[model samples]
Target: MANTVNIKIDGIDVSVEAGKTVLDAAKKLNIHIPTLCYHEDLCVAGNCRVCVVEQEGVNNLVASCAIPAQKGMVIHTNSHKVRNARRHVVELLLSEHNADCTKCYKNTKCELQDLASEMVINEHMFMDLVPDKNYTTDKQSPSIIKDDSKCIRCQRCVRTCHDLQHVSALGVAYKGDHMKISTFFEHPMYEVVCTNCGQCVNRCPTGALIEKNYLDEVWDAIYDEDKHVIVQTAPATRIALGEDLGMESGSIVTGKMAASLRRLGFDSVLDTDFSADLTIMEEGTELLTRLKKALVDKDTSVKLPMFTSCSPGWVKFLEHTYPDYLDNLSTCKSPQQMFGALAKTYYAEKKGLDPDKIVCVSIMPCTAKKFEANRPEMRDSGYQDVDMGLTTRELAVMIKQAGIDFQELPDEKFDSLMGESSGAAVIFGATGGVMEAALRTAYEIVTGREVPFKNLNITAVRGMEGVREANIKLENVLPAWSFLEGVELKTAVAHGLTNAHQIMEAIHKGEANYHFVEVMGCPGGCIGGGGQPIPTTPEIRRKRAEAIYREDEGMAVRKSHENPEVQQIYREFLGEPLSDKSHWLLHTHYVKRKRV
Candidate 1:
């Protein structure tokens, strides 16, 4: 058994694991510790000095986060000395910070704002130190914005970018008050090697970095009576949307979410999972055709190692980071785009509705989705497939403005045909879910055998790990052909652009030899997205991931290939996958943007 240490804080006796910090032990006893620089995932950088605590036999208050707990240690978390030191830390931070919270985007939700209110520090008691500033705005990136004026220099963004993301797009430049967060040599974010994945935005405790809000555009469309608007939500939206509405992380609010949309006066509330299953049919067939073309006819240009193109961030990351691998990206458009195409064509025809008069909207948990929606090739159905895209946060505000009581609202179902989905369709919200979904269909289609593991959870590729790999055999097919003969399936899953960089480097160096790879631009897939709820932490993401799995476990049909709705769509409208109609409507091509 491991050694345990006894410690007491405020008369409570606590036994904690040896080497655990005082802060960790305090949290176990329901004690709150105010911290700024100490993030759960990143290395402990006790720079802010906000978590000072009074301990017996110590001359002064010590940083609880960095100090290890010892046997028989007595600590007072809320002593006068500790409170004074913490207040001074906050006051100093405010002395340089822009204290315009009322006009700030993070007015009600910022960590710094919450800390100030929690510690009862109303004003900057010290002399205001306005350091000479050079960097201010980072509008160069299409997906991300950086405003250094609101930065507290807590280095959370820097650590998340460099340590967790493995993308050192941000760094502390110069020294002392001259310290400022900047791109390489003070260049614009777009000019530097920034992937615009928005990991920095999610980690930022303040409004220093944020997604470009398009709530006003959506609101204008909603108010116009002449416009007939229909909204579609991605599968991941249900798991993460609750966070924006002050609910616990990872709550499954799909039913309430649909009801809320109805209250918002949308003409129809649809499910992108409906289209995600549709993607499976189209993409599954596309993969089979590509493999046949490569294996039978030796088509090296469009051959093995097909990459999933559902994530716009991954698409953009490839465009900038790995242009050579463009051919490897699947030609199929993402489910969001696929829904827009089908809605404007098939749905419009069924309802006798004019495509031009209908405004198709989407609720997404990503900022790169906005960039994807604006792409020129997205218009496959004689018009812009999706007219507008709103983040999960924006949808929450819309629900509030409509005066809908979310908690009291009755559970509702999505629209017919387009709203029906399965567990495999729902898993698209998680990391490596698309790849797993694709594999389930591809394996069965090629081998003509039911998968050995009925529940294709593939836990190896799941979670926030930087990289995950898996391999499967083909022994069930062609007994004469050995398990390793002809084909051997190998795959990898990576989330966050930084990990994508490492994978790209491996591919470039011939270090990795895999048949397929799944890459998501965000750190923890769509659940922990740039356009998700504010103050996204590792703990919150884990909760959301659990919720996603719970949803999957509760699903009737957990395999994408098993979704009857998808099979019916392919049987009714499209003849087969990679058909002439499927090619024109469901599939898409990518372009290389000039680096100006």
Candidate 2:
């Protein structure tokens, strides 16, 4: 049994774990304590001082978020003393803050704003201390924007970058009044080693950091009669988009999402999941080919344990932090880029439309997809493959701007040719999904049998663990792959860049040997992406993962190899997986980047 501490908050007594904080104890009793720098996904940051509570006999109000609960302790969450302190904290923050709430991207979602409203702060008690208008706003990055004046000096972004990601691209530069968050030497974000992952933005409580939205460009394309605007929705977007539109978290709104996009006047509604299935075929084939060369031909040059390349943030992370392992990354393009390449080439040819007239748009849960789309190597289809990338938040804005009742929109289906997908593709939104999907196809091709799991659910690789490892012993291999026929395929899955760094270090030290590895940049995979709905917690991420798995289990076709559209695409256009044509259109290489 664990030690428990008895505490009294506002008069009622409560029992909590010994090491639990006062804030944690208050939450169990349905008490509301507003916080600005406290995020469930991040460490305790007591900088904001907004969650201060009065402890009996204590000289000063204690920061409930940073202090531990004690036995027989009497605390007041909303006493006059506590309330005044919190009010003063908010007043000071507002005084220095650029309080243009209406024009701010995080207007209503801002934690500070919510606290001010809850505190009934009708007026500022201090003079405006905001910096001059000439203060720089960093907008050089294709994915995120940084405004210095709007920052609250909470250090949430700094902790997220340094602790969660192990990519210390952000840090505090000065002391006291001169203190501010900055990149190395205050360089442009794009010029630094930043991976463009939006985790910092997700945890930022204010408008200091936000995704660079492309809604205006998308609107222009929609209004231009000369352009054929088509949008592809990512698998993760379908499950999380509903949260932004006032629906329950993790609600599977696939049909409604497609319907809303159609109402937004897109020429055609496609699915990134379609290309997710295609990615499986290509990447799975690449894995098997490399395995065969290493085992049968005894080829020493083939890189084993190829890392999945679906996450642009992870791709850039490898380029900057671990360039020595670049050869281990899969050459296959992400599903979004693959869909973009096909939209202009195959889809355009099939519809008898000029490629230049088509504007390919993608709705993704990842902000890094915006940066990934603009890469010079993505223009394999003559023009820029994907013209615009919209985050889930941006899509909700469009839905509201069009005045279409999102919740009331009838559930609709995606258009044919590129809209169909399999359960394996749907699971790609969660951690370890890529590994499970590849194994489903790779095991079948090698053994000529369906995966031995009930309902094709690879439970081993599915969870919220930072890193997971599983081994499968292959048996009954066909004569073509008769390299002893008893090889055990080692696989690993890691989410969040910190866990990924551990895996890379293990590989470098020869402590871990694996045949395949999957890495998702954001924690909990795409469901908890930097561009997903805000206020994301471990519980919310778990619910989203459950929803994604339920979607997979409910699908008739659970394997990527069984998707008819993917099979048709290969038979009709690409010829075969990893073919010369497929390599040119679907595969690309990465370059090493200097780490600052």
Q: TM-score winner among the candidates?
A: 2
lDDT of 2 by residue, 434-455 (tens): 9999999999988898888888
Pairs in clash, predicted candidate 1: none
Evaluate model 1: give its TM-score: 0.90
Specify the poorest-scoring 10-residue window by lDDT in model 2. 127-136
Give the lowest summed-lDDT range of ten residues in model 1.
477-486
Predicted structure 2, TM vs. truth: 0.99
